[model samples]
Target: MEVTHAVEFLLLVLLEKLSWSDTKVVLPDANVTCIIPEDCILPCSFKPTSTVVIHWYKQQIPVHSYYYNKDQFGLQNKHFSGRTCLFNSHIPHGNASLLLRRVKVQDRGRYKCYTSTRKHNQEMFVNLEVKGQCAAMVLAPVYLGLATFTASADCFYLFAPAQLWVVERAPIQTVTITMTDEWVTCSSQNVYPVPQISWATNPPSSQHAIENSTIRTTDHKGLFTVESMVRIVGNLTSYTYLCSFKSADKTQVWTASWKNQEDLTYEEGHPVLIPCNAPQMLRNFSLTWTFTSSSEPTLILRYDNRTRHTVNQWEGQAELDQDLVLLGDGSLLLKKPNSQDHSGTYTCTFTAVNTKRIFQTNVNITVAATSVDEQSMQRSWWSTAASAVFVLFTVIVALLQCVKQNAKENRTASHRHNGTGVIEGGLLLYMDLNPSAVRVRPHGAGAHEQESSLVTGPDHCDRTLEPSPEAEQEEEPAEPAEEANEEQRDRFECNEPV
Candidate 1:
């Protein structure tokens, strides 16, 4: 062997010149940030000698210690009291940096640094990050992520592309609150999360808020249905609502409250109840009664648990209280109250199973202002008895038309005071020939001997025919109509028959 290969190459060169003092595994340093209150500088260095010793731990607490010649906090950490320090002449140029002031936010973590000098003891670590300060603001609408922000006022919108973002803000978004109730419609279904509805008023109208018409589909199948409503119109002021239906990560919650606070007059046509209360001996409840006057919200009435049935959409105006409605008194009845269609805003709701209830009212009918002056004195005594029965029917039709025109001028002055040619059964002999006679025949043969031979010379036709004292004073006021026309001209012996 060549001297055994030169003694195995000098024993592999004496084990590569034997000098082992480094197990080798380093990796720490990298993180070190600071901003909470400000200051932080945890770097360090060593390897200079003159007996320079340094220490700075943060796990076993004591942070910052320099040997004998200076800076040595008494086991420091009264939360880094008076905030740590160093750079003391840069620790004689070996620079065992620390500084730390103000920082707090638990000052972050991992920081070791232990350096010593009597020959070898350097440690390092580093990782003390404390961040979250951001305030020099300039983001009006700047989100490098989510999106969709159609705001109206107070804002906190967006989240999509890293999510997306854009924001703008002012304030008020319809806050006029005297809230007599304008919203209450919770819902839920196939629930895998998604729920949130709230409205409060127990004495809190501060900042105003309560106007949601939400309708996540009256929600069903999996469960949910809360309803609340109110409207007393005009001189409004009746509040005390409180509704909450949570579980959108809220873990769960349910609440309901109500109030009506009086102002329900009546008189106009009388018949109103508008009161409600339910939840005492409940029996599978479900009731509703909405009327919201002007803006249309009608659901007049509905009941659904008396074995299921009852709906009164205003036919008969509306009613409820079927024997005290399950003893919880859901009173409502507006029979005739018509103040131009029953004043307005009724709202009554009472559901069961995980319950909910709502009720509100404001009626004021008035109009029977008593007898109003006795109905205007009975309408002026019926217009003076209809003007005295129309003046006695116009004086009995002018005394029966002046006794039928003075009995037709006394039968034409006794047929001209005795002018002849008359026959009762002789067909028709009405003659005074020249006195405008009018005779007609057809009474049977010889018509009374042809009317007695044409009224037979009539003794020159009866010389007893005397009249003329101005026609007997115009037939003396129609003396019995001239004795019945002189007994009809002596039985038509001849006389007047024009």
Candidate 2:
């Protein structure tokens, strides 16, 4: 009976220890699969304490530990030497996570966390699964380093693998909403490892068509110097562009991405990648994509995961990946999505096992306004100048016509003034009345004045006569009297000659 009671007491003590070790860590029941050769973090938390003591174990073997306000890893396993760490600053905040660097296949196991402090203590467990070396997912993983990308919308597209440890579901890190002539530059200097540069365009352009052109050269100090000059905004154009720099050794990386507005924008005349996120891991799915450009909705693309079939009504303008459809990414590939051909609202309806997800993206594709050709402007200016010259010439011709008409009128007036007969008749009337205005005659008598009537000159002399208004009106007899006067003047001159 004594042996039985002792066995029962020992069993009770073991039960108490097991119950006390059961702790709360991040994703207690979930298995976190870490990609090989990358750093992995096993998270843990405890009650806050200034005097912190943390111990990590794998099958009762010490992996890492910290005590007396300092890391005392002398008791850590040699297999994990220099590969484990506890964030010292986070200890006071109840974080007792372990960072395992350069993960290997042997590192895959269930880990136990034992934490202690002056006031409280806690414990937890973390199971890390290791994936095959270089076994990458079909969905491309963005390995961001020490780089900055401004104005890119393709940043939030990193989806976690199906039911695995999520490294990072990517999110937008940077964006630049700038006007024309704005130069977005990403450069780095005095770096040890040679750097690689690339650009991520909104429409997913080819390498040749990307805007970020990075120039790289090694300096004398064996450090890499890299510079990228994103050229001027070709037009008053809006496009989501990103420039990323990564170290060749994959140690340091920088990635920057941004969106122009809350609504998405696509590049005109360039093939674009329209992003769609599935609600969950789809096993058997039916996908439908409807596009509304200006009117009624039309089905542009449809796919079935069960049959591995695709229907595209866009006439080879739309593309899809059936392999990636099973995963979380259901992004559509559009060829030359332009305002003329692809401007609209796109709706992606993904129906799968236990999930019906709908993703929508408004594509506002703006084609760069065609520049007014300089040659055409020159032609227009020449046309305008020619029109002005033509108008001036017409005015000059009109003025010349006026001058000729005035000269003809003046000549006609002079001819009429000189050839009028009424003026001659008026002169004859003056001779009949007072002839002094035309010819004047005075009487000069001599010795023969009594014999010769010529000396008296009663008819040769121009006499001043007083005529009534009625006699002056009769212009008929005045002309004959003028003729007789002329004959008498001729006789007078002949007789008076020496």
Candidate 3:
């Protein structure tokens, strides 16, 4: 009887173990993406027939717990002490989600949530992915050989591989008469899921086709470094050349281009029109006109398929025809072109919609001075001469009038000698005669009578004097007496005295 009882006890224990294994917990694996220094939720839930106990663990380390209708985190890990919390309110509804705050790089791993009910036990798992910030550096093109250039950039990511690309440009590369072959290289370093590179040209050429080569290298941190090179063997006659770098998944692409030169000429005072029409019209495009000279490149105008923008210096002097633009003519018109400084090279760049290709046209303009400028200069000289002659004539007239007035004043002052005697030939003479003091005197009169008889002079030295009536009568009587005395004296001289 003892042996039979032992066998039955062993069978009962085996049967209980088999029944527990048959009731497997239905928990699915999940993935969650979270940024560094932010919060995340590790989701887990189970259907419980009664009150349950929930616990969250990070890689077998206890992070948080929930029991007795509240969060019980006494046995939480040190790394997740104040940063872990369980949803206590959802405990009765069989939810055991864990909220992690201020997630750090070390928090990236697997997590598990375990729940225990009165009837069964269950658990769930979650995978966490943390992404940190990254940086990229693009270097300017370096000339490797004659007509050969290389463009490169370095990109790095913290946790995972980064999407990278390379932009190649030839801002001012020209092929001289002595050069034979030309080459351009575009490269990207420390990238994952390697990028694609291609080349294009305006007025596409077959003789100057692109030949590509790539080299893959690895860093100490297991990052990828891809170096791409493109070579052009024969002569290039295209107006523009383009190079593009695209990722394998086609989510990111970078591009650059080079342009050839053209010449244009215009005369001063005439309107200047620059043609910039593309061969094919796209639904959306961008057109920019830039003036390049000794100074910095000035932006003249920009048309972004929607609106037209004119720069400050070119506001009133430059304009675009909207009607012509609608008809696929992207031209710039300058009115009254007068500045010699405007004679320089101009660049017109066009970017199409939904593509990485760029088309650039360079127009070298020369403005010659017109005949109108010469005529204006001559007229200005004539006006200046006329003004100078008029001013000189007015000065001469004023000087003459001043001299005549001074001479007249001096003559009047000399004639009217105000109380001072006149000086003539070094002799002072008193010529102020009294009119009442002038009288005529007889020849043989007494001294007193002679003194009383005064002589009168003429009114002026240049005029003749006339006699008065009294003087005429006295002269007649004197003449008759002279006649009678002469007759008696001739007859008897001594006897007439007795």
Quick one: best TM-score, which candidate? 3
Best by lDDT: 2
Local distance difference test, each candidate: 0.59, 0.60, 0.58
Which model is ahead, 1 or 3, in terms of TM-score?
Answer: 3
Tens-digit per-residue lDDT, 85-119, candidate 1: 88887676788888888675557778887666655
Error of 1 at 98 (Å): 29
TM-score of each candidate?
A: 0.27, 0.27, 0.37
User: What is the Cα-based lDDT of residue 495 in candidate 3?
Assistant: 29
TM-score of 2: 0.27
Ranking of all candidate structures by their TM-score, best first: 3, 2, 1
Q: In candidate 3, which residue pairs get closer than 3 Å at backbone N, Cα or C atoms, i.e. clash? A: 439-454, 439-455
Task: Please give the clash total of every predicted structure, in order.
Answer: 13, 7, 2
lDDT by residue (tens digit), candidate 3, 1-498: 657645744653354344343355858888997765679988888876567767677776768766666776555667998998867767678778888997765787888877777676676889988754323343454442432222233233322223212222211111111111365555566454456767665666663455666677855333456655556544443445566767655766666555544455667667888766655665576777778778898888777665554343587777888777655577778776654666765666666543322233334444455566787889989999999999999999999999999999998876775434554543243333564333332233221111112234454432222333554455564664554433433332332320
Show the colliding residue pairs in model 2: 145-253, 145-254, 146-253, 146-254, 147-254, 149-256, 152-258
Candidate 3 lDDT for residue 307: 57
Worst 10 residues of 2 by lDDT: 446-455
